[model samples]
Target: MAHQSKRTTLGEIGEHAAIRVIREECPSRNNGDDAAVLNQPAPNTRPVVATDMLVEDRHFRFDWSTPEQVGIKAISQNFADIEAMGARPTAALLALSAPKDTDVEVLRGIARGIQQALEPFSAQLIGGDITGGEKMVLAVTALGQLGGNRKELRLDAARPGQKVVANGRIGWSAAGLALLRKFEEIPEDLRPLVEHHCAPRIETNRGVIARATGATAMTDNSDGLIQDLRLIAERSGVGIDLKSHAIFPDELLCRAGKLTGIDPWEFVLSGGEDHTFLATTSKETPTGFRDIGRVNKNTGLVTVDGLPPRHEAGWVSF
Candidate 1:
């Protein structure tokens, strides 16, 4: 409702006012400083950092996604990158750029969304900058700490005999996007898919669990499953074989695909932005992960049920 009120532009309130809004909405441990002062990290641990950028029309559209949703999605993707490396997120720095005429409430909504997204991990917003730009853009940098004796998961550590497993859902976001593009009004049954596209709630704890459980390699499925697997295969000098039957195809995706005249399998193989954790393990699969395949001697290939996917490319930025 505040967003609906008479537009209070960022230019009118000034930069300090905007920063005050962020500070109030997303309070951090450190305040009144040029840079956040973090406590010394745990001994015998390493820091993991990841950064991602989201641009209007390219990553999301104002008509399809709210300011809050944009904020959440941006944070989710960056935090997911940290988790995939077998670490726990500790803090974030958000840099936002938008037209001077943009509504201050919209920016506040974005700050609130960022705070909400980090609540599950007890992470905080450390510091960032805002500037004027032609279109809305958000650059998020997530910082994480890897603790304990467990080795950090790497994409190149996968080896032959290691089992390929996955945590979290796939294809749901792709299905949601499809529905949004094809239908004028989304059906009630497919609302969950649309929600996924707007804001994915990835399981952050799974990364730590996988590392503790002896995961050999891990990566987040921001790109399609096949595309990410190929990265592992190439980096590890191994091949991966995904068992089609092992993948838990969601019923919602199937229904959406049928309605849209698209194959759900395509979405499963090539769709990205699910932020699901995909990993390899020589030991028992982690509690939350489902075994999907295995690593094999290098053939420089990734296959599903011994056959190459119809499409190999996932989300590509050019």
Candidate 2:
């Protein structure tokens, strides 16, 4: 008789067990309730909510990303959107759609990832649903709290004289994707870039800081610097004049681009998924952020040193 493997599947573990796995990692206040009971914000504060969905082949691939990476990516992206509003992420709701044949360990790994990603912000995974599907689909809804008397940052608030600033890594994810596509075996040096593409780490607290320091407008760089800035410019009736030399490219990204024969500037200006924080500020640039450009009254334009970008601006879902 041949020996049999004992791999546990979603069907074997059932929904309760699956919930146990997630709650074990990040226990909810309303553990067994039909809906999570959350604390109401203080006077004058408002809730900031954002959601992101990741489909199997479209947002990620199992061969390149682990279940943990997928979970982290989903949480980080949604949280970044909340942060863009200059708020502190408080909690999240997760929804998983996967094939019944999916391994229970994979689900547990995803839970662990979500828990770890929320650790820095003191956020919790409050509630969610799990269902069967043809491919793995993860949807994360992140909720945030905007505190203090400062106004919430909006894209339309950017002004003509406000300085453009950025905090956190940019272009690394796009560079990573470029390397991943070109080479069968990624070099050891390039592993960091690949990891960045799989799981980006944004500056979570800068959102609140930007608010306190009087940010005129803000946005996350998930859609590339130029593209996201264009959104601010278009919404605010202003143009952004970026200094060509002001946008710094990391050495690793430059090397990656050189090796792949791709322009590093393209990744800097057009690549998405970095999730860095970008803002227009009236006061001095906040600590942890570097000056990149200035907002102009020209409106509806984003230029690099007075010239339009040669490459495309950013990612388009359609």
Candidate 3:
């Protein structure tokens, strides 16, 4: 006897069933309104929202990443944009497209991953749409709240002579991807570093703190650091000089890369998806921030020891 697929029309599934699945898998923080509703603006506060898209093949490989990793990465990248604006993330709207043949269980797993990732930050899922596509695509928009008298730092505010600092490690993801692609055996102790490369540690709170502490400008190290820093410089009418030695990486990871004939500086300068905060500040930067460079008045350019940064290729993207 042949078994029937559970594929039923939305009419047969019932609206409540669909809502229940989402509620259980990706609970929204908006208190079950027909639509997620944000609170009335607090006096003198403005809501900030940003969105980004990730297309399969362009952003990730289905073979290498679990569905959960895919969902988390999608959420993490969009939330990072909110952090770059110096605001605290409050909610996310995700529109996911997949082949109609995609398994419901797999889709549920992706939603579960999104829920889990949002738990730490108290961000809620508002609403989103689903449609068919040739390949998987995730579009996420994150909403945030700006607090107090502090304005979120924008790229335009960078000033000459401001110290450049970074609030997270660099290159871990690039190295991890390399090892994964080469299928080389990594030592047991290096697994964590490799995982960090798969999913770069995000420093959202640090970004918000830097903004409150008077950061003049900021951007997340999503594109290679040099490229992203150059964006800030161009937007702000400044040039940036980064001290190569100051790019922090896990020492053991660095040693491992050396043994494998990989240049650590390449990871530091051109690796993307690190999600680290590179910011300009006038005040003594707080702990956890490494002073990596400085800003100068000029057209956009990023340099190391007066030379252009190098890259074997560049970070992955679609």
Candidate 4:
């Protein structure tokens, strides 16, 4: 859908061609970010739209991440929102802001990240805008097609006896951030976690599987696990008791925690940027999902190993 001189900077080419470089790198269905009609949803399916914005330093650091990684992270988060609705992302619009002196190669890399990230789910960029700003910012709006009724995936739909199931990586991003904060040169093995923090992965087709297997309620773990689960419990008038055995920190996270002197459970329980999917299913988990616990009648209570959390469970933007 959407460069020229070797090592040219944005100041050299100006913003117009900088836009062209991004367009040239990303795959597109329309001429550009315009009134291009998207593919119609499958018969009887409704459209799902989600947006996400990322800011420098707060969301990502240029020193810690490449422009490509930022692009990938930006689109992936928006796509996760669509996935939470049990929908397939089909199109997207990107809005980017940067200083005029920014390097053209950086824009190319960001576009490349967006291009590669959309490959797994077969989505395309339709339109976007670029502007001069004080900080590097990326805003993405994604459109998806839901093959089922919207009410089926509401947060308040969890019922007692439903199994609490989850899929996707957890804690990896937070662990990565910790390592980045503490170390100048990251260990080779820990680099995957850092990579994940930069461009969180979305397991392909798992959302579709959850929908097909009759998910009752679903959410993506953008906030910490306990904090997000509390939202479901509060809204649905139920409680969620998680089994520590089911979601204990894995070997990589344990290693990271040991290195940083931070308990691995802290990462596992409170880490949020991983975009892991949490859902309420029946007794059997859908493919690619693991049963973590069960829903109960006690409303507004989320417990770990049968006890309330020892500390605040998630990130607060305020």
When sorted by TM-score, best at the front, the candidate numbers are 1, 2, 4, 3
lDDT of 4 by residue, 1-318 (tens): 124465676777876897789779875758464476876567978888989889899999999998889988998889888888788888888888888778888889999999888888888888888888888888999988888553547688899999999998888999999999999999999999999999898887666778888887888888888888999999999999999889889999999999999998888789888999999977468999998999998898998878886544688786
**Collision count for each candidate, in order:** 0, 0, 4, 5
TM-score of each: 0.96, 0.96, 0.87, 0.94
Question: Which residue ranges in model 3 land beyond 4 Å of their true spot?
Answer: 1-19, 29-35, 184-187, 252-261, 312-318
Mind giving the per-residue lDDT tens digits that candidate 3 earns over 109-188?
67777777677788888887766777888898888887777767898888889999888767777666666666657777
lDDT against the true structure, each candidate: 0.88, 0.88, 0.75, 0.86
The residue pairs found clashing in candidate 4 are 1-27, 1-28, 2-23, 2-24, 33-127
Candidate 2 stretches with Cα past 4 Å from truth are 1-5
lDDT of 2 at 266: 87
Stretches off by above 4 angstroms in model 1 are 1-4
lDDT of 1 by residue, 208-239 (tens): 88999999799988888889989999999999
Superposition TM-score, candidate 2 onto the true structure: 0.96
Worst 10 residues of 1 by lDDT: 1-10
Q: How well is each residue in 136-250 modelled by candidate 2, as lDDT tens digits? A: 9999999999997778999999999899999988789999999988988999988999999998877668899898888969989988888888999999999999987777677
Give residue 89's error in model 4 in angstroms. 0.9
